[model samples]
Target: MTIEARFRIDRGSFTLDVSLSIPARGVTSLLGPSGCGKTTLLRAIAGLERCHDGLLKVGGVIWQDGRRFLAPHQRPLGYVFQEVSLFDHLTVVRNLEYGIKRVPKSEHRVSLNRAIELLGIGHLLERAPGTLSGGERQRVAIARAVAVSPRLLLMDEPLAALDPSRKQEILPYIRSLHQELEIPVIFVSHAPDEVARLANHLVLLEAGRVVATGDIQTMLTRLDMPLAHDSDAAAIIEAVVTGHDENYHLTHLDFSGGRMTVTGNAMRTGDRVRLQIAARDVSLTLERQSDTSILNIFPATVDAIIDEGSAQVTVRLLAGDVPLLSRITKKSAAELGLEPGKPVYAQAKSVALLT
Candidate 1:
């Protein structure tokens, strides 16, 4: 199953003309700067915007075409906006019931109880939205959306309204939803950290067009893209918890390329996880260093290099099939004679685990 979308819209000085095929499952993040048409594109997919000559096909359903257009209510989707938008007069359960009641019993796939459990909001069911914390309110809002058993979930900066602590509180629930549900999700956000944490697929927008769209790991590390040149540039690595060293308080993660040890995580053995390795934290050496304090070191082959600025260069490297990025000064790169196919040792100073 896939989503094939083609849209063209013009509003005053801004115009959006883009086409792409998105996967039917997992989270696809529509990422870009402000006013880059991320929200506009999502609205087009949700059938809330009237885009000219648009063609939208989700799974096997034709949402919009030349002759026919499905209304927002007709589409089997649940939308979570930046605002909670909960019914002030209703309890959490009632607000959830409001969403599920819109669909007939014959179409119910996700049970209300399961939705509540998934979002970790069962305890807040009897409370009013005003009484709950920001994170709790957002979790409740997410549960309400899932209660309807949507074919697609559209989240437009669902965490934007929350503070850092609130965001941290609600992120796990969002991650669990992606893992447990079969529904496709299109999330819009300007936060790189949020995208790195949640997205398996990425669609990058610039101005009003899609600049790039691909797997998150590849997209983030692509040397040609602006992400690779940014100070926050990093590589997203998918790994599994192989074991833990109780003595050192460290956990071993094994990916397709190699293994790395991170500070002890709460995950159990065989649990799949994602790791974010910032380019700035990685340094390349011609040979493996034995006196280093870094625990995560891998033998990598240089793939390509791109100049970030007058003094720094971003080098793309490959550890087996996995791609990584290293940002170093021009002097270091020149001294090491870094080039494509050169064998080197990559030392990672820090690795962040994202479930």
Candidate 2:
């Protein structure tokens, strides 16, 4: 299933004109800089912002068109704003119940208990909203939204209001929603780390227009996109835990490209994990080095190369079917004669394991 949206909103100097078909599964992130109309586009999808030439369809069901328009209340969607707007008079469970009461009993796909379990908020159910911490309050807010059992979930920078520590405390609960619920999520954020960790699909907006849209892995590594040139540019790799070295206390993960050994024992065998490899941490070699400190070395074919500045160049490589990025000095690239389809070996100095 897919969500089709077309909207044109003009206000003085700013205009939002976009047409997109977003995947109706997993988390689809709306990523851009500030004042780029990410929130405006999300509001249009939720029926909160009405446009004369707007058309919206979710899973083939028309919500807005020229003939008719569904009001915000009529749409079956749960929205989580940056601020936790729970009623001060209501308890955590009561806030959740308020949302549950709006939905028909017959249409409740997610039970109250399941929502509580998903957010890990069972202990805070009886506590009032004012008594909870920022992270706790956001958890209750999210559980309330899930209790509605809507077909779609829309989050507008749900962690933007929280501090760094509070944001860290609540990210695991948000991650669980993707793993446990079937509802499609539209997440809005400017933070690349959050998008990298949570998003399965990516939609890049620029000056109120859709600049690019694709799977997160492909979009992040594309040289033409702004993501690859960012200071913290990195590649996302999906890998599975193959085994563990008991004596070395290291875990081994395998992807389509090759195997990687990480310095950790937290991940278990047969578990799925995400690996983040920064471009600066990877170096290219003409031949596979047998006597090297880098444990993660794989043969890769150079796909493309772009000069970052006068001193350095960024090289795109394909290890089997997986794509990787490596940043090296221009002099080194020239000496190695790197170009498209050239066989080389990529050495990863460090790898971050994210789950």
Candidate 3:
């Protein structure tokens, strides 16, 4: 199943003209800066904003066509805005009840009990919204959305209004939703960290245009995209926890390319985890060195080199089948004679765990 969209909307000087056919499962993030039509396009999909002429089909259902259009309330979708928007007078159970009541009992796919358990909000069911923390309120809001059994969940920066601490508390729940549910989620966000943590597919928008769209790991390391321009640019690698060295407080994660060991990974054996390796954390060496503090080193072949500026260059590398990125200076590139197909050793200085 997939979501096919061909949207075009014009208002004054700003215009949104884009077409996308994304998978109907997993989390697909609509990532871009402000006023880039991310929200407008999302609203258009929800029927809150009409397109001049468009085609929108979610899975096997046609929500919009040239003339036929489904109103927002008629569509089987759940929308969670930046604000928690919970009723202060209602308890958590009441809020979730409101959502499940909207859909007919025969059409319910996600049960109220399941939503409560999935979001870990069963403990908060009796608490009023005014007494809950920001993170707890958002968790309830998400549970309410799921209680309606939506086929598609649209989140407009649900973490935008929360503080850093609250965001951290809610991210695990968001990740769980992506892992445990079958619903396809279209999330809007300008934060790279949020996208890196939650998204499987990424749709990058800029100034009302579709800049790029593809797998999250591939898109993040693409040297051509604006994401690579950031100083914090990194590559996301999916790995499985093979074992752990309890004596050293280190866990072993194995990916397609090779194995990596990191400290303070509180994951058990056989668990899956995603590692974020910053381009700057990776250093290239002509020959593999044995004596070094860097534990993750693998043989990689240079794929492409793109100049970031006068002083630095971003080199794309292929380690076995995995893609890794390294940002080095122009001087180092010239001295090392770096070129496509050249064999080199990549040393990862640091790795951040994400799941």
Candidate 4:
């Protein structure tokens, strides 16, 4: 499935002109700073915002065209905003039933119980939104959205209203939804870490314009893009669960040319997962060593050496088929005689895992 969207919204003061196609299955994030029109674009896609020239398609169905715009009530969209917009007077179960009751019997693909189970909200079914915590209320809202079994799910910073602790509390449920649900998700957020954790595809917008949009790895390591300048600049990789060491309590994950021993999550043997290796955490070694404490050692061939003026240069490397990026000082590059195709090893203290 695929999503094709374009908008030419001309308000008196703000005009947004963007044309981009997004993937249909994974979580695609509409990322930007505040007032950059991410919310407007999401509203337009959901048929909540009206414009003079707008086009939208989801899984081959046209939600909007130049002359015809599908009514929001008629569209198959489940929307969750920053606020937990639940029926305060109703219990959580009743709120979920509110959405289920709107759809015909045949259209109800996701059951109320399933939504509750998927969101880990079974215990809160009897409680009112006012009685629940921020995370609980947001989970109820998300469960309510999923109960309808819409074709697409649109979330506008669904965790933004909560405090940091509360936000962390609800992220695992969101991650579970992404891993388990079949429906496509369009998430809008300004938080870089949130996007980094949740988004499979990213759209970077600035001043009402889309600057970059692609897979998360390509977007993150792109030095030309704003994300590479972030203090948390990193690279992502998908690895297979090879084995685990019972003695050291370390899980072995396999990637292209080498294996990594990460303090990983629960995964069965042979399961594929994605991991985040931060650029700042990695150090390069010209020769493959034996006395180092580092466990992951890949014979990576340098792909590109980009000098970012001053003291920094980014080295793009190919460890077998997998691509990795290492950020080092220009002085180090000159001292080590590093160049394209020069073999090296990258040592890291830790790697962050998402899936």
Top candidate on TM-score is: 2
On a 0 to 1 TM-score scale, where does candidate 4 land against the true structure?
Answer: 0.95
Report clash pairs, candidate 4.
Answer: none
Task: Estimate TM-scores for all models.
Answer: 0.97, 0.98, 0.96, 0.95
lDDT of each: 0.92, 0.92, 0.90, 0.84
lDDT of model 2 at position 335: 99
lDDT of 2 at 28: 97
Q: Which stretches of candidate 4 lie over 4 Å from their true place?
A: 264-266
Evaluate model 1: give its lDDT. 0.92
What TM-score would you give candidate 3 relative to the actual structure? 0.96
Per-residue lDDT of 246-319 in model 4, one digit per residue for the tens? 77777899987588888744777898777888777777988877898887777888878777658898877777
Candidate 2 C-alpha lDDT tens digits along 1-355: 9999999999778899999999999999999999999999999988989885699999999999988899999999999887878989888888999989999999999999999988888999889899988888888989888889988999999999999888878887877887788889999999999998888999999999999999999998999999998878999999999999999999999999999999988887998888999999999999889999999999999999998988999899999899999999999999999999999999999999765
Q: What lDDT is reached at residue 95 by model 1?
A: 98
Report the candidate with higher TM-score, 2 versus 3.
2
Higher-TM-score candidate of 3 and 4 = 3
